[model samples]
Target: MISKSTIDQVYETARLEEVIGDFVQLKKSGANFKGLSPFTDERTPSFMVSPVKQIWKDFSSGKGGNVVAFLMEHEHFTYPEAIKYLAKKYNIEVEETQRTDEQKQEANERESMYLVSEFARDHFQHNLWESELGKAIGLSYFKERGFEEETIRSFGLGYCLDHWDDFTKAALEAGYQLNYLEKTGLTIIKEGAAEGESNRKFDRFKGRVMFPIHSMSGRVLGFGGRILGNNKKAAKYLNSPESEIYHKSKVLYGIYFAKKAIAKEDNCFLVEGYTDVIQFYQRGIQNVVSSSGTALTPEQIRLINRLTKNITVLFDGDAAGLRASLRGVDLILEQGMNVKICTFPEGEDPDSFAKNNSLEELQHYLQENSKDFIQFKASLLAEESANDPIKRADTIRDIVNSISKIPDTIKREVYIQECAQIMNISEQVLFNTLAQIGQKALSDAGKKAREAQKAFEVVKSEPVQEKIDLQYELERKIIEVLLLYGNEEEEFEDLLLRENEAGDLVLEPESMAAKVYEKIFLDLQEDEIELTHEKFRTIYYLLISSLSENEDFSINTFLTDLDRELVEEVSSILMEEERYTLHQWERKDIYPKEKQAGVSQLVSETILTLRCYLIKKRIHSLQQNTEGSSEDHRETLEEIMNYLQLNTLLNKKLNRVLS
Candidate 1:
């Protein structure tokens, strides 16, 4: 468990915008920050962060809370893990108690796998630095690759011993479970034993140097290991098998280190392999990541999309590799991102080129060599189709198909013009080809939609519109008012029921001065009312007690003590109108009334509405009871009449006309 003092300090020191900004790119909007929803696939900005309130809301997914909550949702960190991450980010010392054996065993399966992966990472790093065989093999290989010690350590590069069960044995001895070890693909198990014999186990990355693959928040999800010796029987690069924690297609190498730089530069340098990413980053190019030797995936592209709209793919001069990577450029275009391609000299790849050139030379080479995707594709294809009319025509259609993948019409048209100029083809011809491809794509999409509809046609019906829950809404409003203005002192117009000279019931108005929370509490208590919703009820009492007790209360500090569910609830209620506020209505010549200006009236109206609703409910219940009652029917009728009259008087005082 983390000490409360440390957690408090972390909450105080860590800024919500700064923490979430590491994962999602945030742009300033009015008094807050808005960004594309990291929790959802969105083209528009709906994720909001309020630094003043220290809470965030994602309107797209409807997830909202404070800094710690964002980490838990985005990074999948446990509460303690989130606090530790914040502590590490802000350079605060975390005070935690040592977990007992039972506590350690209490972790869930996914967390257990994470713990095992983390342990394996540390064990491998220790082997690389301290073990004799590791220093002679893994350390020597990294050194020969021109990776400095600091770079190696920063990326958490390590080594696994050559012996089959060396890593497996070490992990077992360190109190790590073999089940998790096997699940994480650290220890591969083969079952081919007789009744008395045990299943065989061996290290998955034996005789290899380790490169830890991390999530965007820097958790060790898996690893990419490269074999050292000439092993013609084995693959050169091996990755951890798919587990609950690691999916290769969704994982990018060096993203944790590159996210900030990518967002800062507003561009990302995408490469092919782990070494390519490491070499470029070591040479002071920080905004770079790799697909880890796999073909580029849409998932990986979306990862980079979260940070920037520009991707410059770095390729070596191998002809086959260059052709294979052109498909990724289309994928980037489909995502509405700008893409450029840069190739090294004919004999070099990114790793070798960066090793040979100084930082200035490497940076200058990229600047001079990078070409827009369309220009590069046109020139490359134009050469391939030289003096062959059929091939040239096919190439034109191919380029147009790629252009058709772009979502932006203006960009597609601009690229079409550029293509015409480069290939000496008619712009009209290219546009016609683009239209055909787009039409076919739409036709295919329509077919799929119709097929899907047919599948659900048997049970499909019009979606039922849910009726509004008035009582729940009133209860929610009361909580919102308390959260917003509970501590505020305001003069209120108090109403009392009295008998007039004409012997009729009337609402006699009076003046009273009290805190907003005090007036609300007294009104609710007088009516014997309680909130119907469980969450609102809990928060109501919490707010009433806290606001009444503390003269200097803060929502930020108060929220720190609640669990994530309640925190999300409170944030949703508090920021319900944030979207409107973000629009700056006054600037559009639409002056909206401010909530703060009418705090007293808002409180009184909310309580009066609740009272009216409860009275109507009571009257309905009493009328139902009198319908079938055998005894005391007249008494029940009188009670119902009295409640109806009181409800009418309350509504009239609230200026609500009865139908």
Candidate 2:
């Protein structure tokens, strides 16, 4: 557990712009920094970072929070992990409270697996550096591959000694439970023990060079190992088996290292192997990652979709491998990303190609040779279908199917036109095929939705009534004003509307000055009203207490004291306006009203409307009671009539026409 003082210091030291800028490409927009959302795929920017408020909002996804919360949301970091990351980034020493044995045992299973994987990574790294056999074999292999000594260390490349029991014994000696080690796929425990014999335990990556696969936040999730010696019985590369914390299909190699570059370059280079990513990265191509030889999954594509919508896939020159990987292009397109295929010359892969050429030559070749998915697919398939009309027809359909996966109508139309020109087909034929595909897709979707609705209806038999709660929105608005302008003293005016002797409504402006929070608090209390919503009520009390105690308002301080959910709620309120860029109505010869110009009237009207709602509810309750109990009927009727008159007058003051 981190101490409160340490958390506060860390929050105060970490700058919001600097922290988010590491993961996003933010350009200045007015006083704030704006960029495409890292949470969703979009071309126009909807993510905003406010330096003065020390918060960020992704209007596309409705996610907003301070720096720590952003890390937690974007990288899936736990609270302590996020704080530790910030502290490390800003070079602040962290102080944590000592935990008891019970607290230590309370860690969940996934975290335990992470701890075990981390321990294994450190143990293997130690072996690579300090052990004679590891140095002679694992270190020799990496150096022979032209990997720099610094690169080897930074990527957490390591070695496991050939002796079967070496890593397993060290892990046990260090008090790590065998169960966790086995669960992480670091140590394999054989089943069906002989009589009077302990179950066999051995290292999974023995006699291999290790590469630690990390999550987006840089936590070690698993390891991929390359065999160092001739072991025909074993596979050349062995990866950690599926565990609680490691899913190969969902994890992309080197995302932790390449995310920043991908965002900056606005393009990601996708390769096939781990070394391909490392080699490209070492040669100054930083925006690259590998699928670790697994078939690409939608989850992995969505991972890349977070940083940018442009992917340039680097394929090996080998025809077999290239053909097998071409399907990934459609998957990328289906996720609303633009994918281009870049194939090296025969007998060269990304690793060899990057190593053989200068960085400039490699980059120029990539820029000049990369082809869009439609062009690449047609050209690649055309060579095999020459003079075979049937094969050519099938090839055109395949291209059309890929185009149909694209969600953007304009992009789809453009691709279809390009495909028609390349394949020497009529545009009408392509259009008919596209329409058929789209109609089938819609029919399938409708069928699935109907089935889902039927299942939901069977499980939920009762009708649920939802109330139109006006007070909740009004209460939230009041909190919004308090948080945004609480300490700023400003002039406020209310419009006094009344019927003059000439029987016409006249508006009179009355002005006064007060701190924003003071006026809001006094007005609500004067009307004998309190916030009714539970979350708003809690926030209201906290705000008042903090103001009275400190005599100042700090958004950062207020957020630090809030729980995670409350932090999200408060940030949502503060960032709601930034969700859409403000339009310049005046530019088009139209001047719209500004909320800032009439803050006093807005606050007064909000309070008055709330009071009117309360009075109407009271009158309704009195009428219901009067029908059941006639003993106090006259009193109830008199009270209800007076309440109605007051409600009517309040509505009149609000300039609301009577219905």
Candidate 3:
């Protein structure tokens, strides 16, 4: 419902690099930014972001699109949601047309859950700030923990009322559905078995201080609650049960606040608790997030890896916790992330230490304390071994094994040297251990891959393949021509589509893309059915509207609008891997040439030329296929003449280019 101007503002303001740079650490790769793929598990970066095109393509996952499209695909934002996100990012005021009550009432269960969670957060905040009990108990607790009012508001922290059913009553009176409240785990619903009432709803986090868990894009996913009241049998901290909108394993606390800083710093600090992250950020270290309580997952590490190659694990100095957390460092390394370990002094956690120091002082301490994972591990292990050769040797091998997980071949070599320096072992011995573990892992992976491939073959079979008719080739070519040469002016002797469509087709046919599409659709209308190829048909219709409906005729825009599979195929065709022209341009000292113009222009032109050629070839083929069906000489002669004329026109255009 956003106004046209608002939508344009969102799209225009969304700089591709700026938007993507919030999540991925991008280094300039030619004119584009290249970084590790966010879509897949990969070490070497094949993802490319083009500022000029206002789009990005992940060669690994084959997902390519404009900035809004990227957010939609990567972050799962709906189209309007994506535009609003961009608008918010750029701090632009948005103007959206109001939806009707019926429209608003049609909220899906997932969106409804999110709505209820957001309301619960607001209710808690109001209590924290306005109510006496909340200020005395809940708000005081956060302050006692050293949280500033701004930090509390920024994190959306709040207090659930100590009275049971207080939240439940307010939400129901506000016309919010009780079903959504229960579904979101904000309220507990019990169906009547022996009770007089059919249903009962009560606040799930009553008497608790709230931590609103957020997705990277800052959407409220669920809540984590810390009990404020003394209940002897109750646990101190509890999280909302898993719901459709909240998956604990996939969600990380503080990511919403930390993502931008993480990208800016080109590193992420992994800590263990909500306060740990809040304290670090409060201490001017903004690029920090906590696993919240889950054992370190590859998924969690991969989330960090998307932003940066380097990660620093901040652990408490407890010997048991430090040892347990070291295993998480291995997970980071396996994702090709460089890791360092920093443990605070015994009896002191990040929250206390940071509160006691200024930002600069805290940063200085971090810089001095941070040690390369290999060095830290060796030192810690050596102290534990105490000259026991077997344990020492085992520690060396374990360090080597961690080193082997680095997917970058060059990095593996560098880490091997570090391993030698720290453990005081021969580089050859460490290298030998790395190779042994790496080879075994790869062999095991290969065996599993082969087994999966065989299983896939047994379960699935090839569909009845559609033979590529000449028309299919022609249709594709026409689309290509329209996209590339649509804006160009051409002096044409035969503007056949325009002439024939003097009545029904009122199109001005401003661009080559439009003209070609109009001509083909007009010509094809005589056929009994539309294109048999479902994907092709969709593209065909889309291309027609691309020209007939809009004036800008942006190929990148069109590519973004298409379905994902078609978008990938079209983008790969458009973004040819033959980057020789780009390399050659670099040698010419073009000095920061604009991105995608040269590449996309060339692609668009090639498709047009191919299409014009194929259209004539298709008419000839079709004439031949239908020739024997009609024995009448006059009808046959007329068809032959039409085919010849189209051929002559096509050949002339082809010859001009090919020559």
Candidate 4:
């Protein structure tokens, strides 16, 4: 359990822009910062972070919240986890309450696995520094490879002892479960031995250097192990097999460290090995990640898209696997990501070049060498053809095919033109290829859409009953006013438009928000009634608190001071509105209506008061409908009578005010 005071400190100390800016590239726009949606693919920026309110709203996905809530939503951190993340980011010390034994036992299975993985990482790291064998084998191995001690620690490198069962036995002894061990592919559970008398525990990676693969949020989902001995019997490297937490196809290694750099560079440098990523970062080219030598998948591409749109893939120049990896560029194009390919000089890969040169030199070489995938492919194919007519023609079509994978219309046309010039082919030929591919893509999309609709027909076709209760329409209206224009000054008709004693009409300065809320409060108390909707009840409670607070009306401050759940509700109400605070129509320099200022204020006041009155009427009706038997109906009758009198008075006041 976390203390409320600690949570408040974390929230108060964590700046919205500072926290999000570490992960997202936000450029200022008016009072907010806008960036591409991390949750969806869009060229135009719809993710807005408002510094004044200290909240963010993604117009595309409709997720909006304060900093802690954003972490919970964006990175999938739990409430406490998010607090800890913020605390670490801002250097705040955490003081968590001790958990009960039962509460510890009741933690979710996934969370337990996460804890075990974290423990394993720490144990390996500690061993790497403490044990003689680990220091000699693992630490020395990293040092020989030119990795600094800090780099090794940063990447969580370690080694497992040669003896089987060492890691498994230790983990199990530490109160971790064997079931999760086997599930996470850290233990080999055999079926034939001893009729299931322990199934024999053993370490997955023995006599091997460890490289723990992490998620973007730095959770140790799994690990990749590299063998140290000359074991022709064992593979050179092995990774944690797919499990409940780790999916190789979806997880890109080094994204945890590289995400901020990727967004800043506006390019993801995709390498082929784990060492390639580490070496590049150590050399200060931090905007690099490895495919882990696996064929690139669309899921991995989408992960990159969350951070940036441009990806530059770096491959070994002398490697035999170039042909196998060329397919990734097309996949990148299909996702609408701009991709370029940089093939290093012969006998020099990213790891080698980075180790040999300074960061600036290596970065300059890469920048000068990188070519758009289309151009690189065309040039490579051209050289391979050596002007052989048939191969040359095939090369042209292959380049065209790569261009065809691009999704944007303007970009496709431009690439087609570029290809025509490079290959000396007609633009029409390339455009024809692109049109064919584009039409096929559209047909495929339509087919998938139809299939999805069929699969979800029950849900999609179900009738959507109107959520608005007719009796409570005015209640919601009042809520809308409080949510939107509650702080605006307006004229309140004293006694609801009644003439003054001097035979003249006059208006009074009464806060429409306070007056209507007070009326609703009084009416509810008189009938001993309650708001049906929990969210509505929360909003009503907050409104009462706002009234209870001293004057200096501040919608922003009131909202910022709310609890997380109600903050979300309030933000949804406040931000969904498309208001032109510019007030362009109000300025006389442009155009103005007669007495628009006072009339507008008066009209807003009437709307709010009327809404409160109607909500009160609905409450009365609900009270009447919810009455028990007429036999013991004295209190019920009294409630009905009192509600009717309140409703009639509110109605009269509302009509007079509106008129």
Candidate 3 deviant stretches above 4 angstroms? 97-104, 193-199, 230-232, 446-474, 490-659
User: lDDT for each of the candidates?
Assistant: 0.90, 0.85, 0.76, 0.75
lDDT of 1 by residue, 1-659 (tens): 89999998998899999998999888888788888888887677788899988999998888999988899998888989999999999999999888665675688888889988998899899999999999999999999999999999999999999999998998888777889999999999998668878899999999999999999999999999999889799999999999999999999999999999999999999988999988999999999999998898888888888889999999888877677679989988988899999988888999999999999999999999999998899889889999999999988998999999988999999999999999998999888899999999999999999998888757668999999999999999998888878899999999988889998888888999999899999988887887878999888898888998889887887787788889999999877777775556788999666566488888888888888888888888877777765786877787887888888898888888999
lDDT, candidate 4, at 124: 79
What RMSD value applies to candidate 4? Answer: 6.4
Comparing 1 with 4 on lDDT, the higher-scoring candidate is 1
Put down candidate 4 lDDT per residue, 234-336, tens digits, no spaces. 9999999988778899889999999889988888999989999999999998998887867899878888886788999998978577866898889999888
* Per-model tally of clashing residue pairs: 0, 0, 5, 0
Q: Rank the candidates by TM-score, best first.
A: 1, 2, 3, 4
Candidate 1 off by > 4 Å: 100-102, 192-194, 459-465, 581-596, 619-649, 656-659
Give per-residue lDDT, candidate 3, residue 576.
Answer: 44
Which candidate has the top score in lDDT? 1
lDDT of 3 at 43: 74
lDDT tens digits by residue: candidate 3, 1-659: 88878877767667889888877778886567788788898776778877765667787777876777688777877777788888988998989777554554477777667777878889999999999999999999999999899998989999998888999998887768877888888889878878586777778898999999998888899988998767878878889999998888877799989998898788888888888888787778999999988798998888888887789888886778677778888888878778988988998887888888899888998899999887898889889887799998988887788777777899889889987887778988888888789789999999999998888666567898878665566455555555555555443322333324434321122334324455455545643336656777777678777778887777666765676678765655444442333344567776543345433344334443544555555666767777657555676567766655554554454455323
TM-score of each: 0.94, 0.88, 0.81, 0.81
